[model samples]
Target: MRIGYFLSSEEYTPAELIEQAKGAERAGFSALWISDHYHPWVDAQGQSAFVWSIIGALSQATTLPITTAVTCPTVRIHPAVIAQAAATSAVLTGGTFRLGVGTGEALNEHIFGDAWPEAEIRLDMLEEAIHIMRELWKGGVVSHHGKHYTVENARVYTLPEQPIEVLISGFGPKAVDLAARIGEGFVSVAPDAEMVQRFRSGGGNSRTCQGGFKAAFATSEEEGARIAYEKWPNAGVPGELSQVLPSPKHFEQASQLVTQDMVKKAFVCGNDPEAHLAMIDTYAKAGFDEIYVANSGPHYQGLFDMYAHSVLPKL
Candidate 1:
């Protein structure tokens, strides 16, 4: 399995983010996965830059391949526009970019005053969006009409040497099957083995699969839990339900239910080298083509340093 790095979009400044990307590449990570967000889920998570711009910056900063952990092409931005952006980015990055996409949430999508689409509608949108993007990248005029969208003749001018690979983010069975049928790669963060199996059964090939686990690392486990709750209260599962609920306060409220112990189980926390190495191994055993880990709390450099100096050496 290849080791990869994941960055929380809100966690660092653009310059810091670029530096971190370089650090990870130097540390020998095979690739980089960065979150795409327009707004921080809460005031606490704190910064969201235009992810495409950041992807461009990282392309210059490091050689590590970059992927949007998942970007919603159908909602905030038209797939045609995203197609141009992805194509240009891949060409600039020397074909080092992968278009990791998913049906997004109200947080980013609602910005355009567009109604938040339901799961079924989102999936439908995703299918059509993928079609639009792929065709545009083929380097000629293309137009598309589908249940959720219609495009006039459009073509991306600056294309990449290689066609970009599309990775679909999926969680449940229906989503998994769709990813299998359409996506070149499957992306997930949940530790569930069944999700991977379902993804494969649903038509997901023996292609690249990327999965991540998060941890709140600190000197004290109590401090770790506090940080975990602050950053991500909803730790156990993944989906859009938590997003549509009622308020940002609800996420903070739900976060209160998550304990440090729960976060620890999900991620190998603390300064222990063995613990971190084991966490990496667990994902490898789960058949992940790439395993990504992100630090939930501060001590970002510590975690990166640990991973590079000790854990990466061992791996």
Candidate 2:
């Protein structure tokens, strides 16, 4: 499986993130998966930079193939606008960019003052948005009128030589089916063997399948767990809360219920190379073509060095 670094736009400055991208490439990671968020899940996790700007910088800073871990094109931004941004990114990256899209969360979409729709409606919207974006990416004047979106005489003038591959992110069976129907690739947070089989069964046999997990590398296990709990306790927030929580403050409140123990259990914390490799193996065994690890703490250089020397070689 190809190993990649997950750039958390919610936690680091744009410059620092670009530096991390450079570091990741130097360490031999084959690709990058970046979070696209309008707000950090909780205030303690810090800044949320514009993901498109960071992608532009990363394209210049590193040769690694980049994929938005998942961007929500159904809301906040129209599919036409996302299509244009993604087309530009693909051009900037010399066709090494993949657009991973999903049904959005209220945290980002609700900021536009629109009522958050149910998951089913959101899925429909996502389907329509993907169709519209694909139409726009064809490089001519295109007009679309669908249930969820409308595009009138829209065209993407600056597209890459290759058609941008659309990767769909999904958690449930229905969403997985949607990905197989429309996506050239698929992404999910966990390594579910059943989900991979489902995607393949739905006609995604030859598509890229990606999964991501979190890790916190530190001098000691205690320090790593502490940082993970403080900065990413929100990771432990159960189920639909993450999708519905509208503000950082709301997430902070929800995160208070997430304990350090839970955080430690969710992430592979500490400097044990074997432990990190074991965590990555879960995805590999589950049939993921690629796995991206997000470092949750400050010791990224150490993390990269460890991965390059030990974990990566083993994989």
Write down the TM-score of every candidate: 0.93, 0.99
Q: Model 1: runs farther than 4 Å from truth?
A: 236-240, 246-250, 256-260
Model 2, which residues run further than 4 Å from truth? none
Total clashes for model 1: 3
Colliding pairs, model 1? 180-203, 180-204, 233-255
Candidate 1 C-alpha lDDT tens digits along 220-280: 6667667776666556424565546444555666666666566556665667778778877
Lowest lDDT sum, 10 consecutive residues, model 1, at 237-246
Candidate with best lDDT: 2
Best prediction by TM-score: 2
**Residue-level lDDT tens digits of model 2 in 1-315:** 799999999999998899899999989899999999999888888889999999998888999999998899988999999999999999999999999999978988898699999999999999999889888889999988789888898899999999999999999999999999989988999889999999999989979999999989999898999999989988899998988889999988888898999989989899999888888888989989999999987899999999889888887
Candidate models: Cα lDDT each: 0.80, 0.92
Candidate 1 deviation (Cα RMSD): 2.0
Backbone clash total, candidate 2: 0
